[model samples]
Target: MKRVFIEHIESYLPDERICNEQVEQRIRAGGFDIQAGLLEKMIGSEIRYYARNDEQVSDMAVSAAQKLLHHYPDRKIDLLIFAAASGDLIEPATVNIVQQKLGLTCPGFDLKNACNSVTNAIEIASALLLNNSYKNILIVSGEKTSDSIKYTNIEKETIKDHFAAYSFGDAGVALLLTTTTEDKGLFYQRHQTFGEHWNLCRIEGGGSMFPNDASKLVFSGDTFGLKNVIYEIAPPFVKDCIQEAGLTVNDIDLICTHQVSKDTYRMVAETLSYDVNKIMQTFHLYGNTAATSVPIAYQQSLLDGRLQKGNIVMLLGMAAGINISVQLMKV
Candidate 1:
């Protein structure tokens, strides 16, 4: 079998930077008393990137992919896979726009399994590499959650959800996966799904099932948005993925779980008996960037010099429909 390794990773965040203190102020102004330490320790976010309304999800993805290409100009790319939930437009796959924007001429498409899109795309890319179908695959994950945030509904009792409103930021990430002879590539990957939990997290508007109509112009209290569903199912799914990877919590040198929140990270880490020190978190600094979380975390690790050759790294992802995917790679 051919080994598939991430050759390069890059991330692009919006220009606006919103820190935790600012979020606290915003919350306090609305009659909430969330502590600073709680935001730091629980949400694990110091700041998050925010994009302007004009900046679409595909735009960020293109920008990140361009950065990757700039770094490795000579590298030949054979495939591209864009993964995201908050796309620029609903009908045309985001990858189509990305392909045109990036000037990439290859077999490319979009993958959507909620936040797990990137992880599942990696699994598929690895299989393609093993079969000698593609030499290099570019995986781009981007999310613009700011577009969907309903800030009008903010109150003390619903502050946690409001925290979700502020907690999620926009960002894009691109990774290059290439085939190699060394074992330092993709070692193992497992995909699992619990479709019964599909409705747990979703955007009810602008889709065929629930078309955006005049009556649906305004969101309601029970709209079933991001906050209500993600918090309910993420923790357990993280544990299940880690366990299925066939390694103890300690076996992974670095854990790059989804960038949901600090509390969710701690809860999942505690459940798996993994030390907090072993995890790489970008959510606090970058917010919950949906499909882009893992790749952004990967790039941040590279920047921090935490990821070295021969290190054992695990990529854990959980999406709506309660989909869970875990991939083990030797750096």
Candidate 2:
């Protein structure tokens, strides 16, 4: 297979910054008594962002993609992929909207895999770039998770299911990938899904199961059960990826991850005996932006100089559907 290099990467976070106090305020607006500092304490996210009411998912994606398209004005995109767990519509794949909004003539499609959507897109695009004539593929993602929070109906029994929602933040990320003759690109990637645990996390409405029920639109999940599974699978799972890549934890210069909870990186650091500084902890700052989590953190690493050209970076992801993936690459 031919090497696939990331030509460029960028992110677009909404202007409206939200702190844990704001999150608590909104929840309290429902006239419910909630423990203060619960979100930051449990989720470890001090701040997250929400797009304005008029902003759509496509808008965010286009904003991110525009940065790349402008950076390389002479380059042409042979293909485009919109990968995300959030979108502006249920009909007409989000990729179509993104392509149209960006005014690109390239063929495009949508890919969804809960929080690992963008990582999966990169895997697919790498294969296509290796085999096909296309020189470059652009992947973009936007998450508007704030739209799904249910502040009003906070029954104590069902509270367990909604805590995960508080950790969610909105974001957009874009990556431009192309075939490379050099070694700086994706080399090893693996994904495993435990479908039986799919019921642990979900947005119950907007699908055929509960089509007409608006109340089912909010995020709901078994947090304790999900964490149990994470602990069981993630440590061994990550060790496998690093071994298969013919590298050790020290060989990995940076770790970009889809943080499903506050303890996501904490678990990785403890299980692997790797330095905590090597891990990118976006959950505390950006919250879980679903599919954008890993990519945005990857972008931040580049800007912060923690990762540089030819550095070994691991894209670690754990999403709903009980999905987990590890992609080792050079940047």
**Top-TM-score candidate index:** 2
Pairs that clash in candidate 1? 42-263, 43-262, 45-284
Q: Tally clashing residue pairs in candidate 2.
A: 1
TM-score of 1: 0.85
Candidate 2 Cα misplacement greater than 4 A, ranges: none
Model 2 per-residue lDDT tens digits across residues 1-331: 4698787899999999988889889889986678997876787756789999999999999999998889999888999999999988998999999998999999999999999999999999988898885888999999999998879979777777898888778989899999877778889989999999999999999999999999999999887899888889878988988888788889999899888667888888888899888999877788879999999888888887787677899999889999999999887
Q: Which ten residues in a row have the lowest lDDT in candidate 1?
A: 214-223
lDDT agreement of model 1 with the native: 0.75
**For candidate 1, lDDT tens digit of each residue in 1-331?**
5688988888888899988777667656755666765666656646788888788888999898999899888888899998887787777888889999988789888888878888888998888988889888999877887666544446666545334455677888898988888868788788777787665455667867668553332223321454445545555665565576666767788888776666656755776778888888777677888888877787788799987888898887766676767788998
Model 2 C-alpha RMSD to native: 1.3
Best by lDDT: 2
Per-model RMSD to reference: 3.8, 1.3
lDDT of each: 0.75, 0.88
